[model samples]
Structure formats: C-alpha cells, structure tokens
Target: MTATHTYDVAVSWIGDRGTGTSGYRAYDRAHDVDAPGRPTIAGSADPAFRGDPARWNPEQLLVASVSQCHLLWYLHLCSAAGVVVTAYADAAVGTMVETADGGGHFTEVLLRPRVTVSEPGMVAAAVALHAAAHEKCFIANSVNFPVRHAPTVTAGA
Candidate 1:
C-alpha cells in the first residue's frame, strides 16, 4: 500500500534553541514547514501551536483512523441489518509511551469510540456491528497494538 502528502515552508520566526526547543511543519518530498515560530506540535513556545486543542495529533491520528474505520464499517453493517443510522460521532483518544528499548517511541495505542445511533433497539446491534467492524478494520488488522472498542449508545428522539 502507498500514501502521500506534501508541505512547504517559506519563512518563520522563533527564538531560543534548546533540547526541546524545535518545531516541525509536516512536509513532503519537496518542501519543509519553515522553522521555529511556524505551526507545529503543541507544547511548543510558539503561540500558534497552542491553539485548537481538538486538532488531531500524531497519536490521535492513529486513534481516528481506527475509529473512522469502525464507523464506516458500522454504517455498512447497519444498512445490511435494515437499520437506518442518521449520524455517528466518536470521541477517540490514543495513548503513547516511551518504548521499552529506551527510545522515544510509542508502545501502544487505545481507541475509545463513543458512537451515537438512531432508532430504538439499535444499541445492541450497533455494539455487535462495532465488534465486526474491528475484526474487519484494515488498520486494526495491520497494527500490532491493542485496539479496543468502548462504545456508548443512545436512542434517537
């Protein structure tokens, strides 16, 4: 499988240089995201990095990939089961820790998907569908980390 993205950097303004004083702009094979004062991960000295707490982080991206996969699969499953789902939303989170090898690597990630469904008596079906989705999720199947589904359901009015 293959994927691609691109980025560029014209200029930036940032001061001070320390061990944890650097920032990154997601880039492609062609360009880079300026430097220092430019947009970057949170916890950086730059004010721009501090905004949008809900923005997807690297780990969060992993979680979202799985959550979205499950959601899509669930939709298909519901349709097959004659259930009409109006909307689905998930508040997913991923956890990262230093690898046991001592490098700055994530050892594991947990995906928590809180899904909302429409119609009565669909909660149980949604839960079962989520399980099936996890089994068939391409990302979950490819990753070695544990992907768990903690689902919460509510009936629509």
Candidate 2:
C-alpha cells in the first residue's frame, strides 16, 4: 500500500508600498513563505522580473528543493546499504527557458554531488547509490523536467 503525505504553507504579499500595484512597476515583488514552526522564507521573483536580487527567488527555491530531496534520499540509502558516507555536498544547477511571451519553464536540473566515504572499498557502491537515490527522490519524481546526477565519490580520513 502507498502512504500519502500532506504539506502546508502560507504565502503573504508584503511588498505593497502604500500604492497597491497601481501600475506595472508600482509594487515590489516581495513576499514571505511561512510554515507552522519554521523560520519564514523571504521570497521574490528572479531579478530579471523586477524582483530584489538579494532575496530568494522561486526558481532558486525549486532547484534547491530538488537538490535537498535527492541528498536526503541518498543519505538514507547509503546508511541502509552500509556505505559510510563521511561528507556529502551537491552543486546543483537548473536551466530554464523563457518564451517570447515572458513565460518560462525549467528545462533540466543537474545535481553534481561530491561524496566522501570512509573507505576506498566502498567507493563503487557509494557511486552507484546516486542512481538509486535519484530514482527514489520525491521531488525528482514529481517534476516534469529531467533531473540528472553526476556524482564523485572519494575516500576520506
């Protein structure tokens, strides 16, 4: 049997500078993402769309979500498979193409994960686990675009 999970968040616009979007360039593209007990995430559109460059954008958050999901599943699998992973980091990149009408969609995401394991003997299994982790990633399974991984495994002290 399959189990179901539900997530909830609240997004509120906090960018009306007393003008309330009277014009196209009137309001700032700022908002707050809140969950029950977590710190609020300040969000905006990508700076290319007249948003603050310093604030987190939806595009970045989406890419981060994919990266985090993959990493979590990879760790879980590594533990169960007896791969002693000492360190793990991923430099994930996503590409999005915009249409002539100012709409866009992500084309793909590449997850470059650098994993440090405790022994050289475990390298092969550690390297192979990335594919399994990708297969099991919840975010990757839900996305329309392809999510690919390039993993590097090294023995660590």
Backbone clash count for every predicted candidate, in the order shown: 0, 0
Would you list the C-alpha lDDT of every candidate in the order shown?
Answer: 0.61, 0.96
Q: Against the correct fold, how does model 1 do in TM-score? A: 0.59
Each prediction's TM-score versus the true structure: 0.59, 0.98
Task: Return the lDDT, model 2, position 80.
Answer: 100
| Regions of model 1 farther than 4 Å from truth | 1-57, 100-108
What lDDT score is found at residue 26 in candidate 2?
92
| lDDT tens digits, residue span 70-137, model 2 | 99999999999999999999999999999999898999999999999999999999999999999999
Candidate 2 C-alpha RMSD relative to the actual structure:
0.8
- Among these predicted structures, which one has the highest TM-score? 2
In terms of lDDT, model 2 sits at 0.96
Among residues 3 or more apart in sequence or in different chains, the pairs in candidate 2 whose N, CA or C atoms overlap within 3 Å are none
Error of 1 at 28 (Å): 15
